[model samples]
Target: MPVAVGSYGQTQPSCFDRVKMGFMMGFAVGMAAGAMFGTFSCLRVGMRGRELMGGVGKTMLQSGGTFGTFMSIGMGIRC
Candidate 1:
């Protein structure tokens, strides 16, 4: 199907294509958010474990969680 160049170039993308692309982009972002959360959680746990084994780790899990959430939001992460 040949499209006239000027009209084709100006055409808006269809709704279905927009929805599919949005879903794909959001999915990638969601995966990145999940990874970030998992890593932060694991780090917190390791720090907690270290407290018992004798390392001078501060109790900053709450701050870390807040930081992670804010960063994800700043990155425009969406479902």
Candidate 2:
């Protein structure tokens, strides 16, 4: 039998590493979308500068947490 050799002998990331990466990516994307939505919603409701900042902050936190949790759970199940 012939021996099989890897091209560069590089190992792939582990399941845990991939799950962590997915969680981080999901959180980042969720936070960005939340910030945009919060800004627009606040503007539509006539919220001013400071209020807009607060709204965006709150939305980003909530969105990040929610997405992170869901991603972790999903990845855990799959992995």
Candidate 3:
């Protein structure tokens, strides 16, 4: 019997995987950015307590989604 010396495996991620990774990274960055900007804007606009929390949350989600979508598309295109 002969022994095989080489191993073969998937060296690249699939399209879906690339998109997913991009989305996750973009989402995180977007959320952080949204938080900083949202906080200042909301505060300057006089939002307080529950309103402040709601505003920030909304901003975070929106920005995260937008960023994630674009990043995913870019990643997919590069593939």
Candidate 4:
């Protein structure tokens, strides 16, 4: 058998892996932004307690999902 070069069993990440990582990173960033906005809006509207939590949750989920979907589409095109 021929000897392998470089890092042996360690392989470079494939396009799919890179895309998936990018998508996850984008989703996290989006969620953070959404949470900040939601908190500000809730405070502005005088929302309190559970209502504030609910608003933040909704905003985060929506933003993360939207970012993930768009990233998926973009990655698909690149592959």
* Alpha-carbon deviation at 41 in model 4, angstroms: 1.3
Q: Pick the candidate with the highest lDDT.
A: 3
- Tens-place lDDT digits, model 1, residues 1-79: 4433565477544455555555555555555555566557656667556553332222234344444445445444432
TM-score of each candidate structure, all chains considered together = 0.41, 0.77, 0.86, 0.73
Using lDDT as the measure, what is the rank order of every candidate, best first?
3, 2, 4, 1
- Number of the candidate with higher TM-score, 2 or 3: 3
Candidate 3, residues 1-79, lDDT tens digits: the string is 3333446843556678899999999999999999998999999999999999999999999999999999999998997
List, in order, the clash count of every candidate structure: 0, 0, 0, 0
Comparing 1 with 4 on lDDT, the higher-scoring candidate is: 4
Q: Sort the candidates on TM-score, descending order.
A: 3, 2, 4, 1
The lDDT per prediction is 0.49, 0.82, 0.90, 0.80
Any runs in candidate 2 off by more than 4 Å, and if so which? 1-6
**Worst ten in a row by lDDT for model 2:** 1-10
lDDT of 4 by residue, 1-79 (tens): 4434566686556678868876887789779888998889888999899999998899898888788768766776785
Instruction: For model 4, name the residue pairs that clash.
Output: none
In candidate 2, list every pair of residues with a backbone clash: none
Task: Report the C-alpha lDDT of model 2 over 19-72, residue by residue, as the tens digit.
Answer: 898789879988998898878888899989888899889998889878887887
- What is the lDDT, from 0 to 100, of the residue 79 in candidate 4? 59
Off-target runs (Cα >4 Å) in candidate 1 are 1-10, 46-79
Instruction: Please identify model 3 stretches exceeding 4 Å from their true place.
Output: 1-10
